[model samples]
Structures are given as C-alpha cells and as structure tokens.
Target: MNMLRPACVLALMTLTACTQTWVDTKYQQSDRFATWVDSTPSPYRLLAGDDISVVLPFNVELNYKGRVAPDGTVAMPFAGNLPAAGQTLAQFGETVNRALAANHMTANAMAMVAVTQTAAHVFVGGEVGKPGELALTPGMSVMQAIITAQGLLDTARTGEIVLIRRSPDGRPMLRTVDVKALTQQGDPAQDIVLQSNDTIFVPKSSIAEVDLWVDQYINKALPFNKNVNYDINGARSF
Candidate 1:
C-alpha cells in the first residue's frame, strides 16, 4: 500500500510537470504569433534583376525605367551603361547622381529613385494553397509571401515551412519557419525577411502533426492530469 502511495504521488508530480510543460509550450508558440502583429518592418535589401524607375524631376528625357540588365547595368540616355547590379537602390541612386554630376549633365541634381516593380522573387512550392513562383515586392514580409502563395493547404504543416536561400557566396541555405504560429498567433519574427531567389517550401503537415502527437504522448504519460490527458490523448477508458 505504501508503494502504491508513492507511485500515485510520483504520477501526480509527473502529471503536474507535464501539464506545466504543455502549457509552457503552448504559450510560447502562441506568444510567438501574437508578437507578429507589431513586428518591425522588414529591411530587405534590393538585388540584381529588380526593376526600378529613376526620375530626374521634370527631366523625363533622363528618366529610365527598365529591368536591371544581366550584367547589372541600366542604360540611361546620358549616363550610358551604369553599374546597378549588386547595389542597393540607395547605392544605385548615389551612383547615378555621381555619374550625372561627373558628366556635367546635372549639377546638384536630386534623383528620385523608386522601385516601381520588384523583379527579385522567390518560389513557393509543395503542399501550399498555391504553389508557384511568387514575385516579391519591396516591403514584402514572410506573411505576405505565404499569402501570395495562396496560404497553406489543408495538409500543409505550418511549422514545417522551409525557407531555402542562397548565401552571399551562392551556397544554399535552409531555414525552417513556423507558419502556423505566424498566422494563428501573429508572431512576425517567424516571418523572416525574404531575399531574391529565395524559395519557400510547405511540406505536408507531418512535422506539426508529429509535434501535436508528442504533446499528446506527454499528456498521456502524465497521471491525474485529466484535462490534458482527455484533450490530448483521447476518450478516457473509464
């Protein structure tokens, strides 16, 4: 009888620990999504292949709107072929300003550069609501990307969304993001800033389902935690 008492106490303690852990995990995941509502704006740098519109203020003749050439140069009437590849919009604007000044075309001229369109795009593939290439616009966020992909499919694993990107040296990099947390909890941090040529993959809901299953298992392992045990494990035996 004493041994049964200890077992019962141990079970109760285990149950309490499991309940706390489950609550912590739930809260953590929920908090992550909740914080996304007030997330800071994404600061993604422009890259090659982005289309830009450069206006010289009442100088339509000098204004250039076109795609960044393969070599990263845009041909302006007076500026000739200028380097724009691998340069941010600000840098490109500065380069254009310097070029215009050097060529004596415009002295102390103010150049208004706007990204009318963004050619830098990423691909979203697999078990998503829409699987295809998604064009990334300036100020685009991860949530936007997923939304552009038509949201996740019914079988989409919110936590298994994988972001594949290229490193500075062109090496492939992979990052796993939680889409469920982002959408359900409003966590903006999980919505990482995307880059040109980035790829997002929404694998089937295996991972999330597994996590839920694990949570269920932990609940089942707990003793006297009726609420969690019933909710997670299933109908009670007696």
Candidate 2:
C-alpha cells in the first residue's frame, strides 16, 4: 500500500487545484446509474467479423448474407464490396441501397440489414491480472469481468472501482462501485451487471487521490476496443 503512495502523490501533484474542482463538478456520485445513463439503446454498429444478412425488399434475388471482412467491408451479390464496419444497420442498408440504385441493379433499392451475430465485449484495466477486453456474455457483472481479467492484483482498491459508461445521449458518465463488498463481505449487491462496451477500472489504492489516477489510467492509459464501442453502465441483478 505504501509503495503505491508515490504514484498517488506524483499523479495528484501534477494536476492544478482547479482540476480537483472540475472533478467534483464532473463526476457525480450516485447509486442511480440509470438516471445518468441514456434511456434508449444505440443502434448496433457493424464490425469486422460480425455476421450480417442483407435483404433486398424489391430485388429478392440479390439478397446476400456474409460477415464483415477484416478490412471492414462485406461482399455483396451485385454491388461487389461495400464498407460495413462502423455503420449502424440502417446506415449500412442505405449505403447498399444507394450502390444498387446507382448501378441500376433494382428500381426499388430499399434494403434491410439484419445482424446475425456480433462480437460484444467489455474492457477491464488497472490493478487487474490480465487487463484487456473480455467477451460480454449475457448478464456479465463487475465481479465476472474482474475474474475474467484474471482477477485483481494485491494492490487493487476494490472499494473505489470506477465504471465509465456512455449515456444514451453519447455523453460519458461515471460511477464508483464498492466491489469489495462482494469479494470480501460476500454481498451480492456489490456485483453490477455490465453492458456491452462497458469498461471496468479498478484503482490501485486510496480514493483520496483518485482524480489523477482517473485522468491517467481511465482517460489515457486503457485501450478502448471499438467492439460495441461502449463505455459501460450497470443495472443490478442480485
């Protein structure tokens, strides 16, 4: 614990006094994560390796089914290859329709894009064994993500785990969860069910100097894998 003290001091000292004020105003502490999070779900964006089926409403013969290529495209029946990754189903459908109409493949080019499969994931970092992205299985929770990340380090401050998630409006919101309750006290309520694209950041030590660590690790250090491209929020399931 004392070993992490220097890092805490160095991290905190680098910031100006106003930074602390900003943190206070910026990260509101609340158990009601749903309130801060957007109410609606965002459309699923296509990604490399995601399986999808394209249906031509008018030209049924040209319907195609395939996976998004590693280069972020799909090979179609008539339009050849079109970019699929990063675009939502509706957006991708529009792209396909435009391409079909331009080439005069069909008079009515309205198409439907259906997601057959997706590689949903969540990121876990800091004070964990194997900090990286993990596949987001149904009902994945905070405890599960930590365990999948190879579990926590001896220096982990489980009481101050920071969960950053994007709201429906696309704004990033944060929550501090006390997972120590679940790990140490066996309190099931401490386990928070995660969303796809959610990130779980366990702190190294004291919450007294969390601002710097949050800025350093949560903001800059961790890699935000574009899978689901989500910052996670929680809905309880205990």
Candidate 3:
C-alpha cells in the first residue's frame, strides 16, 4: 500500500545513515589517522637522563661515556660540561665537532654521539597484560609498545586502543587505532610511531573508558607527586 511505501523508505534512510556513520568511524581509526600521523614530526630530542656515548674516531682519547646533566650539559674529558639536552644526535654531534675544531683539540675530527640508553617515558594502561611506564626506544611503534606492555588481554577492545599525545601546541590530543586491523589485516599504517610522554590506553570491548587511571598511576607516585601509593602494583620489598 501507499502508507507501507513511506515506512519502508524511512527505514531505508535510517539504515543508510547508520552504515555511513560506521564507515566514517572505521576510516577515522584507520586511513584518516594514518594521514595525520604521517604528517606529524617525530624527531627525538635528547633528555637529561639519557646516556650519550661520544666517540671521536680520529682521537680515541677524546672518546667518553657520560649522562646529560640535569642542567642540560654533558661533561667531556677536555670539553667539560657543554649544553646537550636540547639537541638531537646529529645536531649534538655537529656541536661537538665544531667545539673540537674551534679549540684546535683535534682537526678534522668527526664526533659521533650515540644514545646508549634512552630514559624516555611512555605509559601503557587498560586491558593489557601489564600496565606501567616503559623506557622508550628509538623507532618504537604503537604495536611495539603494546608488546612491551606484555601484550593484550582477551578482554581488550582491539579496535579501541587509544593513543594520547600532546599536539605541537602542547594540547592533549587523542587518536583511536584499530589494533586488530594492524595485526590481523596486516595494515602497517595503523602502527604509528610513539613519542615520549605518549600513553596507549586499551579499553574494554563492552565499555567506553578514559585515562584517569593512567594519571593516577603516574601522577600519584614518586617524584611526580608526594602522595606515594606503595601498594599501586603490589607489596614492595624496599
């Protein structure tokens, strides 16, 4: 009948809208996120706790191992403590080479500064096997982060793993990733590069969750805050 035609058309429209929304959400978690991540800069900056191994290939005597001081400097044998916390590996290496050339310590010396240890912080929480702050490594990806957290649990929402990061302007931003799509579908684009202070949160499949727990675990402990909850993970020996 004529009345039935109108009802059928309305139902069809509703279904179409729902399908479009589902597609859009999936695209945001996949292709759209990939585009955004590809455009973001991922340069690694040296931090105070990071250990740098400087090797003067021509002058082995100048070779030394040291940590970047809290004052953003490194103590070399001849160079003393020079500024280093803000520079990248290449930039710091160039600065060291220039210093050697300027002081006439070693002419034609190419200084190489390598990060033997990175003290970069990355937090992993939610339905992971282990949830805690990890020491980040160069070239680490989101998938690797999950692995370092001891992999995911059976209750993990594989499609709802959220990455919390600070934007260029220092504002917090969130990106959802379909981890199953990355692992099962073999989509490398979903595997985004992680930066320091980044947090990966995997919510339960049945519930939508936020990162307040991550803040508690990180902020409520140690030098970050004074309220130390020694029972956060388990009973401690020390």
Best by TM-score: 3
- lDDT values for all models: 0.64, 0.71, 0.71
* True-structure RMSD, every candidate: 15.2, 16.3, 18.2
> What is the lDDT ranking, best to worst?
3, 2, 1
Give per-residue CA lDDT, model 2, range 1-238, as digits (tens).
2343354334333322323332342445543334445333456777787888889877789988889998999888788789988898899999998888888887578899987766667777777898766766546789888998999887777776766666776555666678888777998766778876676777665553586677778667987443433435643332
Evaluated against the true structure, the overall lDDT of model 3 is 0.71
For model 1, what is the alpha-carbon lDDT of residue 40?
Answer: 46
Clashing pairs in 3: none
List the candidate 2 regions with Cα displacement exceeding 4 Å: 1-26, 29-35, 38-48, 51-118, 207-238
Candidate 1 residue lDDT tens string, 105-212: 887556777787776666776666776667778766666888887877787766756565554554444556787788789887787877656666666555655666
Where model 3 places Cα greater than 4 Å from the true spot, the runs are 1-38, 207-238
Best-to-worst ranking by TM-score:
3, 1, 2
Alpha carbon lDDT at 177, candidate 3: 78
Q: For residues 75-160, could you state the per-residue lDDT of candidate 3 as single tens digits?
A: 77766557898798889888888777777798776888899888787777767888767788887889999999999987777886
True-structure RMSD for candidate 1: 15.2
List TM-score per model, in order. Answer: 0.61, 0.45, 0.68
Better of 1 and 3 by lDDT: 3
Error of 3 at 143 (Å): 0.8
**1 versus 2: better lDDT goes to:** 2
